[model samples]
Target: MELDFWQQRWHENQTGFHLSDVNPCLLKYWPLFGGEGLDENKPATVFVPLCGKSLDLIWLASQSYSVIGVECSEKAVDAFFSEQSLSVQKEKSENFNIYKSEQIKLFQGDFFQLSKHHLASVSAVYDRASLVALPEAMRRRYVKHLAAILPASVSILLVTLEYDQALMAGPPFSLSETEVEQLYGSDFEIELLCREDIIDEQARFKERGLRYMFERVFKISR
Candidate 1:
């Protein structure tokens, strides 16, 4: 999707996809991937790409890693800080207003404009809505840019949806296991940590006349 599309969505408050609470999967599984106790006093940072106003950022902060969120929408970035009741001091970067606080900083600009220097301090990635939010044409470019800028030690926790594509056009694109491996195989070791079939429980998806809903968590390491 184009950047304008997202900006318009946020302007219209059309963020039905934004979760009201922290993701359950993140809370339950974050510890397995070197959570708070594992990396104390080390000054490690985690990168959240295209981060919406999900409470996952707060959760990540609680886990002891400084959080860096890159977002294109100004409304989303503003809402994130405002809802948290935190004051953001904005500074002008080359192409963004860097909204910064103690443990969190948000870059309000194109994600592609971010350079290695901006992300060099980061050691891990937590992607809940980034990859799957893009269309097929954009996904490869996103991955390539991410791989180019991020260091090899950076690990990633990625969540994806899997379902029949013919039924609906999606911001939440469906990705199969094979596609996941193929996309990140070049430099990252991708592990499937969990997969859940939720065809029965999701009445909304079922009401759309969809047959399946699959949620998968992947761990990517270099």
Candidate 2:
């Protein structure tokens, strides 16, 4: 999808994917990557890409990790801090604008344009909606750029949805298990942490004639 597609989504408040609460997968698995009971002397930073105004950022920060979120929409980024009633300091860069507080730092710009310099300190990644947001063509580039920037020790906690694409068109696309392996298996060690049939929970998909819908969680480490 082009920038306009997402820009329009935010502009029109067509953000069904934006969850009001922290994701259950994140709450359950984040600690495996050192999100909980963090040591003050050795704090880690978690990088969140395509982080559209989700409550997960605040939850991550509350776990004592510095959270850095990259979002293309300035409106989404602004809403994030504003809705939280937190004060942010802004700085301008050639590629993006930075909105930062004590625990959170948000970069308003393209995720693909971010470099190692921008994300070198990241010790882990939390991807709830990023990979599936793109089409199959861009997913390859997203994984390539992600692997290029993060350190070998960094682990990723990714949550993805899988379904029959023929049944529905999506920004919340169908990402099969095989596709995840193809994308990140060569570089990172992949582990399927959880898989659940969520068709009943998703009334919209059920209404669209989708017989099956599954949510899968993967733990990826290099």
Candidate 3:
């Protein structure tokens, strides 16, 4: 998607895709990575890319890992801190403003513009709506940049939506399981953790005449 597309979305407040509550899937599956007994010895930072105003950042903070989030829209970044009732100090950079608190720091700029130095400490990534939010043309570049910056030890928890794209123009783009595997399989050990058909539970898409919706979870490690 063009930067203008997302900037306009933020300007018009057309962010219906942003979730108000922390994702349940994040809470449920996160522990499998490092919350309890699993890999607590891993690094202490988690990277959240294209992270809009999701409460998942707060959940990450509660888990005791510092979170670094990158977003293009300043409004969305501001909303995250305001909605959480946290006071943040802003540091200006050439490409972005770094809004920081005790546990979370957000960079306001193009994700691709971010340097490896800023991301050197991050150990993993949590991508909920980020990948699908991009248009098909941008997904490859997005994945490539992510792969280039993240350390070899990093892990990824990604969620994606699948559906018949012929029926709808989407920001919540449909990506089949095979497509996801093709995108990241070369670099990481790709594992499919779960796939669920949530067509009946998806009221928004159903209203738009979409007949099917699939939710997929993927784990990627280098």
Predicted structure with the largest TM-score when compared to the true one: 3
Please identify model 2 stretches exceeding 4 Å from their true place: 35-43
- Please give, for residues 1-222, the per-residue lDDT of candidate 2 as tens digits: 887899899999999999889999998887677735322233389999999999999999998889999999999999999999999999999999999999999999988789898887887899999998999989999999999988767888899999999888897899999999999999999999999999998897799999999999998986
Rank candidates, lDDT, best first: 2, 3, 1
**TM-score of each candidate structure, all chains considered together:** 0.94, 0.95, 0.96
Q: List model 3 lDDT by residue over 35-119, tens digit each.
A: 4634566558999998988889998999889999998888899888998999999999898899999999999988998888898
TM-score of 2: 0.95
Higher-scoring candidate on lDDT, 2 or 3? 2
User: Which of 2 and 3 is ahead in TM-score?
Assistant: 3
lDDT of 1 by residue, 1-222 (tens): 789999999999989779899988788767756645433334479899999887999888887789999999999999999999987799998899899988999899999999899998998889989998998889888998999999767788899999998896787888899988888998798889899988897787789888888999998877
In terms of lDDT, the poorest run of 10 residues in model 1 is 34-43
Candidate 3 backbone clash number:
0
| Model 1 regions more than 4 Å off | 35-43
